[model samples]
Target: MRKLLLLLVCPLLLSAQTPADQILAKAKAYHDPQDIWPTLETTFTFKETRPDGPDRSTIIILDNGISYMKINRNDEEVYEVNGEVAEVLKGDKDKARALVLRNYYLYLWGLPMKLYDKSTPEISLAEDEKVGDKLCKVLRVVYEEDTWYFYIDDFSGRMLQYKFYKDEATGKGELITLEDEIMVDGIKIPQERSWYTLPEMKYLGTDILEEVD
Candidate 1:
């Protein structure tokens, strides 16, 4: 009778302690407790440094899904897109560059918090792993086009690093270390990100969030 009782209780406890549920709860609380994105209205500056090229700076403003991006490489205002309308403000902006910048800023600045988005991809818990010196709880997210691995700090429940695969089968990808943070309007945003090539760990450019509001 005692063994049967223990078995029943054990199953209940396991169901109550799913890894995805626990990790997501902590992640959401740490990153965006107030759900700022729906009414998010803010501006920030991104300074990018690359080993192969001159530094580039951009000022980005996102007001409720409408976006304006200014590319400072040549002191040019390159793109502006709002709802159904899109424009190339100046300097012969191409659609490819515009799209890259759009996704780049949106993805990096809105991380961990963005994991909770309504359109968020399918997410599941993976085995725990160490990122740099910190042990992390791994969350694997699969989008339509790519798969991403987010490493949440085991102790603080904060996202410390992430990896993305260009080809999931080959596992060739990049890893980014998220460092420094600033709280803006109840959102914890990473202020700097350094990227490195996977396996080889080649140094890539760093994107620094210089200013925010």
Candidate 2:
């Protein structure tokens, strides 16, 4: 009886020995089919809609190395990120703040898409969890002195959810959750993001992206 049990479990164990690093490589190859991610500065438009209101604007932006972003909504200015205030031509403080928030939100939620090339310490297989009905292998990641939890589907190896625990400096810091599915260049990507902050509040947003040349 004992021998039979060992025989039954041996293959399952060996087949499931996928580390987080290996899974990440496979995921990048599968998810980023069209290579739309920005490696350098680029400007493209986006249509943003909220339940309370809807708006269409030209999302002019720069993504220099290190994720520096400068976004202009139509002829009006609304966003900037990691940019020097002296360099900006806009004088509206409200627009600057909006730009900064936009940049921060976009950058945080748009990751795993951006985590395409980064490699860090690889951890052994942790556990398995289900994000939807799909079974995923949960992996723990520590980057930038911050800890994060990720779930990647077993077969497809695509990242399903990325949860980041904010550092202690901001006593009111919180957790970031990225979810949902968005199709980009025919590839499904993360579309919904729930930014859970301290004081028991959350900023929930969704990005329904359509790929345009």
Candidate 3:
């Protein structure tokens, strides 16, 4: 009798979650099946290519459990942040940019999982969007001043692209298309990200993940 009651309540519990919750769960399962991101400690080595500049190489070390991060560009120190304080070791000494990059790296690398962060105010199911030839389920996340849309493959639950708008009404923002994946520490992370202007689709650049440690 107890086993029958448990089986009956399981489906009901799952169905009670909103569409946004379900989609996020699927996406998270694909990206971080082991659920190890909260205490994740890893190093990322990547190359950045842009039409306007020469290719650049960057290395980033992150330990999410302690909120610690360090970034290096071309073998030179860019910045390091531990907890709330950030320091720029060389170059311009821009603490502001360092802090921003801290958030930027963590958020981008942490993907659908980061969407569940407490700092994230809202996530909702949005109309489906086509990424290239494949149709994807869309998730809209609202921030204080910006709105972001993430396109996830319906069947595989992998993130295909994401766009953020400063002006939601005018759709003035950038679109980032994800390609390929790198498996590191049991996590599937997008290998390449191509950036373009929203409506114009002006080509910007691509960030390619080369290796991880």
Candidate 4:
């Protein structure tokens, strides 16, 4: 009876240790070891640089526990969204745009921690691949409209790059590469995010985290 019990438990353990689960767990441990991101409240100031235009600075405040976010662009109040209500303080009163910004900022910064959310899309593992010269483990997440692939450093488990595609067959989308990091509110946030066109690999823009308070 003891031998049978051991045999049953071994398969359960092996099955539970999936490649996707292992990669995500390692990444979450590196980024937010204390698991403090879900209730995190903080401010981040960053600059967006592009070859085609002048640099722009933006400030974003996020309080996830209360589902609140506010964005300021170029020293002007852009919008703030609290729960279901969006207050547009500048520019056109577009509630949808405000809400989109709220989600985009929160999700992009939250990263591996956000992947743990129950409402997040399904996640699976792809074969090991290389981004640049670093060997990475790929995590494929399927959303409602598009699919995203995240590449995590094989050794350190840090997120190195990610790409999104509306249609995988077309191979037309953008790839965002993460570099450097900053520790803010006990969370390891990427300092530079460089964007490039997929396939063509044309340089687009980069967002650099300038300060956090």
Clash totals in order: 0, 2, 0, 0
Backbone-clash count (model 2):
2
Candidates in order, TM-scores: namely: 0.82, 0.56, 0.93, 0.90
TM-score of 4: 0.90
Q: Of models 1 and 4, which has the larger TM-score?
A: 4
Deviation of model 1 at 129, angstroms: 0.8
Candidate 3, residues 92-153, lDDT tens digits: the string is 76888888888888898789789978888878999997887888899998888889999988
TM-score top scorer: 3
Q: How good is model 3 by TM-score?
A: 0.93
Clashing pairs in 3: none
Candidate 1 runs further than 4 Å off: 1-18, 65-74
Model 2, range 11-91, lDDT digits (tens) per residue?
887677666656765666666655555544455455554445665454646564655666665556555566444134454
- Estimate the lDDT of model 3: 0.89
Deviation in Å, model 1, residue 55 alpha carbon: 1.0
Worst 10 residues of 1 by lDDT: 65-74
After TM-score superposition, the amount by which residue 152's alpha carbon in candidate 2 deviates from its true location, in angstroms, is: 1.2
lDDT preference between candidates 2 and 3, better one: 3
Candidate with the larger lDDT of 3 and 4: 3
Model 1: per-residue Cα lDDT over 52-160, one tens digit each: 9988888777775444443344357567656435566677767666667676667778887767667886689989999878899999988877789989888888889
